[model samples]
Target chain A: MATLELRRLRKRYAGGAEVLHDIELNIDHGEMIVVVGPSGCGKSTLLRMVAGLETISSGEIVINGECVNAQEPAERDIAMVFQNYALYPHMSVFDNLAYSLKNRRTPKDEISRRVNETAQLLDIAALLDRKPRQLSGGQRQRVAMGRAVIRQPQVFLFDEPLSNLDASLRVQMRQDIRALQKRLDITSLYVTHDQTEAMTMADRLVVMNAGRIEQIGTPMTLFRKPATRFVAGFIGSPAMNFLSGNAGDLPGWLPRVPEETTEPLTGDISIGIRPEHIALTTPNAGQIDGHIELVEPLGSESLVHVRPTGHESRLVVRHVGTEQPDAGQRTGLNLQGPFHLFDHHGQRLATRPRLADTTCSMEP
Target chain B: MRYHRPGLDVAAHTLLIIGALAFMLPVILAVLASTQSPGTLFSGTLPLSFGTSGLDHYMTLLTEPVRGVGVPAWRLMLNSLLMALGIAVGKLTIAMLAAYALVFFRFPFRRCCFWLIFMTLMLPIEVRIVPTYGVVAELGLLDSYPGLVLPLLASATATFLFRQFFLTLPPELMEAARIDGAGPWRFFIDILLPLSRTNIAALFVIMFIYGWNQYLWPLVTITSADHATLVTSLKRLTIATDGTPPWHLATAMTVLALLPPVVVIILMQRWFIKGLVDTEK
Candidate 1:
């Protein structure tokens, strides 16, 4: 319903430490962007700034092509659902939903109608008379959502709205939120530290680290083509493994690198291969050989941890019940699929360049 | 359910019974003495038996006007009630708003303002009675209900108690309301006020008693009998009478003065405990 643009957004505290650097992002109408990051990554601060709950230290926030940097939260025509389900504890579910409309001077009958519709949509009609404390966690979460949706604002902001729910409820609410968002076709910006939620629910994922955007793209695109060493290791469950080596040696261990990158051979390279991309083969059958250190069976697929010869860090392999290597057994790892390679500065180096690229060589 | 200890139970029950009797003895003796004439009190032994003149003495105390005391009993009771209610309601309003501002707003020198209010806790009306009386007199609030109520309005304990409650409130609620288009006044009336009802009730009980028991301030502030509280009027009934202590109507007035606070405590025993301990929401 609305497009949101953050132009060179930055947040600096009074103590002179910048918590969020110039974060530039643009969202199309009806797009759901999930900002995923670690705890101190400033994702929540960014969301709050968009919600107008936090003051912007610099830059502009434009919603629906109208600059709202100086506007109040209510004046921004946005509604937010909080992680703790911040439904008013003293108000009934119906009153909670009706609060914003009543404040806007909506007709009483119209307010009641909208509340009823939202309650029915959220499947919380039976809970309208109950106080927040009387309801269960998931029920309260629905009421929180209902409160926001009843306003029918142009944009919705969710700050880890499912973080407090149980794991099963979290999964259920995740799908419910996505379905609701699509059904209403409302623009949303959801923030969470859970990568799975980001991958499953986001139309685009904005991966952040240490106050900066590491990468922003679709989940699969970011998964397959990460832009930095941080994004490569962050977006996956059993995070991508990085092996440090020279570019000339990448074709031997990680065949994902292209040929003819004859940069100075002394430059260090961080080669990343996802755990699932590596295959288990007999010793002497592949380019790299290692001894299995542990086997973790995860029902569908088992993660095999191996200590590659001459390397101190252990590399993991995902196997689908085939060629399961045991403890202290010698195995060969075939990393013939696509992988990520970064330089010492953590910026991703080019792969599949038609000719020798100057970017990798410019790292020095 | 936690344990089964017969000896401890017996010891505890026995000690509690003796303690209860020890506390109730003075009130019981006062009730019995109010039914008797002043001569029986001079007989040296405490009266254990009820007297025949109970209704007569109470009726006279309620209906008849006493010498040297300018106000009647019922009017004095009315004034006391008004003063206590006014003080309780007034203090709660001021303290709750002060606490709400202190907890929710970020202003310059907010901590300084809070500590200044907190410093008033050390100086009760009894300690600063003269100065407070001087201010009240200068303002011409003397001999008025506002005079009785205004000087003792500010309550640091109630303010801090409400401040603690407001601090425990999650900040997300405020943000959600803000996002819901609730201005500050709407949020306070619709959200904060209802949330603070229990704390207000508890503080009301405590403050009402505090205002009801104001003896020194009322003595210093109110020279007119029309404005005297029941607590101050109770002193007028103590005739001394060659140190025999009249003992009859004096006991009746004492009983009357003690009833309101005791009734309040018993009526709100549950909320009183919750308010005092603050162990629940």
Candidate 2:
């Protein structure tokens, strides 16, 4: 296992504009880092650069303290699981898992032993003779994983490997992958656009936007204290609601907004509040009043969409149980314990107390 | 409720039957002509008369002088096989390598090279025949297997078809193979080529038929009748007029010439359609 460091990595297609900018990330040994972003955000490009599928335009990718920028993917000693589960359609599952070993000229008996062991680990021993086309989506996914696992390379790279599976299968495979990674403790870099997958499965979540790193921290740290408005909005399901309210409108129960120095908040500043943090209360007890636009109930919880009076912004609140107010009914919103405050430039202000606050403190 | 369409179905089936009959007509005529004696073939008397019983035609083709040239039909058949197989193997190897490069590499001037190669498709061999002949003659490849095969080796049609095929293949397959420690050649042999069996089979059938039926190039290049392919030999045999055209033996020879390609098409019919259809998808 090796720590993979990408130092100011940049990628630009021939005669085309740059797709990725100066990306600097250090993946420590035995760490599982998930690069999460939206489509066309260059997450896949970054992963491909590390895998040697893409050429490094202007920077170095050092793996195990050696610069692999000039090396072929084969010489890099990495294994990758592709999103589409790129199993050889013509080969049986056994052959698919054994292909890499055979290519490396491994001994026949050892190849068989390793393949069989991986097949068993993936619970696909009975499917050894089946081709990829014959397998279901989930089975093909396991076969793709098995193909990578049998190699036991220095690093594992997954490019949205579970995105092809059904929801239940994706959840199951997510747990299986986490368990496998923890057990093997291989340095792995997983790329996905799914924020939940990144949040649940990563040792560190590298949130990206527009070919730039928005934030890199533990999942909870990112959720609680995102370093930018982009991270606050992108890292959660239903997304964090951004309110364009001034400091004068700050609720008395919540912490005071950070004072502006040198650069005053003359323009618009964004206040980020996650759905679950916002509470629905009686009109007199709440800070802001709005009419309920919609309520999406999920058995134990409900998402209440509220449009505050005289404001263009609609806020979503996650309330527990089926206790939901009727649509078009005037309701009040109570800002909860933690909220993210961002300047007009989208930089988070250092008002909250958290580990991610260190960087914010130095910014001012 | 949807209205039932009666006349449309009847018209569709009628048109389809007519199209099927039109396509089957040649094979039916060939089968019937092969069975008839030479004297009765073009007699145009009865449409379906069982002609004079004959292993004579088959035996005659085995022994008869083809045209005034005295080239045995069996030798011509063997020549056709050698030329076709040579062309098929050569075209497949070159096309696969070229296609693989175009699909998965980033060398300098790559797109420009691809466009230049692809541009050759617009200029058919007919357009370049005279110049091609001059080049072949200048290189002294005339009347040899290299003369017959080399000009056809760099097939833009096969390269184009294989490129389209390889482009549809998930890029991840190549990436996965590379990360598994397989170099470009290893990836091609172990991953890309194996997954491309249907495409290779389809291209093989198409190239074999093309080589088997090639007349213009071989006709101009091959000076020796012994080295001549079946199509050229057939042209000579049919146009000879030394004696009564041995129509029965000639038909049998034609049948022999058609057999290999026909068998290939039949055997690989599934993969041929699969390759074409999957590529469209």
Candidate 3:
């Protein structure tokens, strides 16, 4: 219901060590922004700062066009669903859902109506009287969601809320939360270390590393066009392959090398290619011939690990369908034109437009 | 998994019966002595049979004043009840508030304050009875209920137990409450106090019994018979210095004194176990 803006947001501990640095993000109204990062990357810290749980070292947090930097969490008109649910252990489900309403001094009958409505919405109408300990993990998650949603706050802040559930339950709750957020049309800020969850849940993902945002874009844009070497590695499962070599001494076997760039490709360059973008061909027929070292079959697709000639490291080629090249078979790797090129500084270099135009069916 | 050894079962039952009888012997003797007349009590080698004067003795103890002390048994029972209830309620309140402040707030020297409170465990009322009595007397609390209860009010053991229990609560609960628009006082009254119900129940049973059994402090401070507690008055009933002691009335008073604590333990025993087990973290 409200747009959340973090301008120059930074977090520093009393010991003078910075955990979050110059985080600038602007979330649109009714949009779900997932801040994805590795552990200790300060994604949760950034979310906590937005929630008013942590002090803002130097920044302005604006919600609904009002500056909330000095406001308390309650005064900021926000509700947070913690990673562990954080439901009051002694309270029943009904009471947990009705807590914020009662705190705001709502009428008795109105509070009961809203609580019943919320419980019905969550399909937990039968669990009104049971304490938190008696409920299963998924039921607890529903109650936690009910607790946050019943208030109808300006923004919902989720601090890795689905991380505690089992795998199957995590998937189900992830979809349920996405549907619920859409139905309510509430702006939400979710933090998680799981890239798959972020890729599916976020309208736009804020990929953070070492307290700074590496990129802020849609899932498809981030996956297809990573701006840095770190984003290229962090965004995809099975990760992208990186090969380093001198730029001026480009081997003849290298496929579709960037013909030109504003910055001179002089000292060294790295080639980044997605595992799915490399097709295995007959050895000595395609560019960069190598022998397949191993094949990891994962039902529909199998990842074939290849060792290129004169290279110590192995390159993984993600091949679609169950049929895969056998281990120890010699195969030539064909580069699908859209592979990335990074300079010596690990920054992505501008490539020709035709290379980015190859149709990608696997882009989620 | 089911062990159905008849011989071992019989042997185990026999041992359990012996242990139970050994523990209940003193209480059984007290009940028996209370039932008998003084002459019947002194006549035999600890008579196992009940005397016919049981009803008469109990009625006299309940309705009439004791011969030398001139105070009804009910009055001493009421005094002990007040002292026990007072100490239990007072200790729980102080301990809970102290523990709440220690665990939830980040004030200056909070740990130092906790350690100072913890240090009092070494200086129990028995260890510092003289100085405690001096303070109570100087404050004009002698021969008053306050004198008996106030000196035993500061319980370091209960405070420590509460602090440990409070520390087991997740910090996220407090943050959630804050985001839910609950201030500190609301959080304490609504969330914390309700969550601490089992802990308070367990501590109440303990502190009540501890205060009821207090002998040395009441004996030192309470000079007037009007303010005598059950345990202190029982001492006066036996050590007469002039004539044969009224063993029947003293035994009757002892039986009365044992009822409240037993009833309390039986009532709160379930919650006491649950509290200890639930807050183990």
lDDT tens per residue, model 1, B113-185: 9999999999988888888888988999988888888998999999999999999989988898888888888
After superposition, candidate 1 runs with Cα above 4 Å error: A246-266, A353-364, B241-244, B270-281
Better of 1 and 2 by TM-score: 1
TM-score of 3: 0.94
Q: What is the TM-score of chain B in candidate 2?
A: 0.88
- Give a tens-digit lDDT track for model 1, residues A302-355: 899998887788988888874456788999877655657788878777666444
- Candidate 1: true interface contacts recovered: 0.83
How high is the CA lDDT of each candidate model? 0.85, 0.83, 0.89
The C-alpha stretches of model 2 lying farther than 4 A from their native spots are: A245-268, A352-364, B1-47, B238-249, B270-281
Name the weakest run of 10 consecutive residues (lDDT summed) in model 1 chain A: A355-364
Can you give the TM-score per candidate against the true fold? 0.94, 0.88, 0.94
Per-model TM-score of chain B: 0.91, 0.88, 0.91
What ordering of candidates by lDDT runs from best to worst? 3, 1, 2
Best by lDDT: 3
Candidate 3's C-alpha runs over 4 A off are A246-252, A256-262, A355-364, B1-15, B270-281
Best by DockQ: 1
Candidate 1 TM-score versus the reference: 0.94
